[model samples]
Target: MAGWEVRPSDPGRARRRRMLGLLLVLCLPLAFYAGGLWQQYKAPAAVVGALPVTVQDEQLLAEVEELRQRLLVLSSAEKVSQQANEQSRLTIKLLEEQIYKQQQDLASYKGVLAPASRREGLRIRTFELQATDRPDYFRYKILLSRVGKGDTPLEGQLQVAIVGKQGDQDVTHELSALTVDVPEAAPTQSLAFAFKHFQAIPEADRFAELKVPEGFIPREIRVRAEVQGEKPLVRTFKWNKEE
Candidate 1:
């Protein structure tokens, strides 16, 4: 039996034992590191509740707090940049709309001031009243031009008067009176112009907004202008019904 015990060792069994020993040696450090991590950061119960913390856990918690602060700073910067970009887009859109409106106004004035627009001396070229999207509101554009006069400017003050039915009776209201929807109104109205060939009443001088009375139908508009050396030029135009 002693001789049998000393028989040749199995090569595979020896190799397996050596490998197992080496594996344990290699796994000892990893196991210690995992235990340290669990004790410091992870709850012993493995459920989301209060943990029994140690001094080392405070350091891990501090590291987590630092990571949270860094994340907040990065996220705040991204949010501000996005908001700034949105504001820039809105500003650009508004400017584009303004430019488009100015261009249209310029083209309209150019047509009215052309050389052919002068059919007679000190005449009304166009009187257009446009209703806006708001109820009881209106906007008007009046073009006054003098023709056959060579290079001499026409200096005068123009006045606009509206004729419509306020109620059962016919009524007349000036530009300033129509600023309010009421019938009894005091006026502060003057549309003055000095141009070589033509004049378009600017926004400040024109009736840019008009508040009409409810159920009132406009019949005619009178544009009366008094030149520097001549008598008043009176022009009565029928309200454009189709518009």
Candidate 2:
């Protein structure tokens, strides 16, 4: 009942594998088609020119043939150059896709392996605060999971506060003040999320739409997750502009 109840499936990994499989399926036929085109022009121009011609048009035909030969050579060079460029593009694209997938794999693996087994109950994983592109806006993410049977859901109310400096002294502000408190609106602001195994706080609801005073600078973020009949789990993260 303890340890992993079900092996966590990486949906992103499955999608990447499917894409790579489709790419391989697509590339094989393309390669074969290119090879077939390359093989069709095997015979030399000298053989074609040596064929017997009518007596009156022989001199004119020879001049025409020379021009034809030059044009054919130029066309062949251009065709090969075009094909090489296309192949180069495909190769670059494949490499870039591969590198991206590898990076995703590394991140997923770390997420699974980095934390040691707790054997029972709930635990919070990574918590990150990211500054958004919009002025005075920031985003935060928290991942929660339970170890053991996972038959009973972990019920908890997650509360977050921004601890900043109003002047010389520190001040704390609840995250709910910046967002709507409702099931229909900003659920992540002050919602109780329940999960048997894990849950991610929703993306749209993850950001704190702060209205910090002009002079007050944010210094720390404190998150308190209180489970039923259990002591509140608290995590304090230092905030700074540079990071």
Candidate 3:
């Protein structure tokens, strides 16, 4: 007869086997999902092509630098042009002033040569004072003219005095006292003159300079002309310097 074998069963071991089977069943979906994610991560990515550079773009790049250089050159040229224009304007202004001065001198000469309506005898035409480089030193000029067409030379003595204040007292300084150089033969008090039509003081060949005394404030000038056979003429002029 065939022998029948019977073994004892463990309840805890059977329970453990069933739990493992259930856990395996639960993990099946997670494993499948993880495998799909891995596949996507390993796949190659799509590429994008770069834009092509044209000839016109390259030309523009070269022109940008060239234009910058040209702009700098043009700026310098403009500055130079402006400076030249300013210089030209200044030169024109100076020339105009010279022309005006010349015209005035011409008019004065004409008046002296032909005075249709003027008093006869020696008359003061112009008196001018120009400051020198030295302080309180000046160059003075006096223009004397005789009216009418008389060819006879007029003889006279001119006296100049500076009227101003010295300290608090009013004072007068004669030309003789202020003259820098005094002639040995000429009178020390007055300047003698002999001219037919017109004459300038100290003559054109000589230099006449006056030194103003220290602490002397001048206001106006007093000129006196004592001509032979004529009444003494006295004239006053405000103290001013020639430009």
Off by over 4 Å in 1: 1-120, 179-186, 203-207, 241-243
lDDT of 2 at 53: 51
RMSD score of candidate 3 (Å): 14.7
Cα distance off (Å), candidate 1, residue 204? 11
Alpha-carbon lDDT, every model: 0.71, 0.66, 0.76
Residue pairs in steric clash, candidate 1? Answer: none
lDDT score for residue 94 of model 1:
58
> Residue-wise lDDT of candidate 1 within 96-189, one digit each (tens)?
5455445545654564455765455676666766655577787666766655645777788888888989668898877767764433534655
lDDT tens per residue, model 3, 1-243: 479778998999999999999999989998999999887766533211122345567878899989999999999999999999989976865665455445445544665677567776777766667666578998676777776777789898889888899999999988778878777454357878898877777665334788899999998888899987889998888888421
lDDT of 2 by residue, 1-243 (tens): 688587888999999999999999999999999997766664544446656454447978889999999999999999999999989976865665455445434543454444456445666654555554466765555566565554778898988777788889878777666443334455345657797766666532233244555676888777788899988777777774312
State the weakest 10-residue window (summed lDDT) of model 1. Answer: 180-189
**Among these predicted structures, which one has the highest TM-score?**
3
Give candidate 3 regions above 4 Å deviation: 1-108, 113-115, 183-188, 241-243
Rank by TM-score, highest first. 3, 1, 2
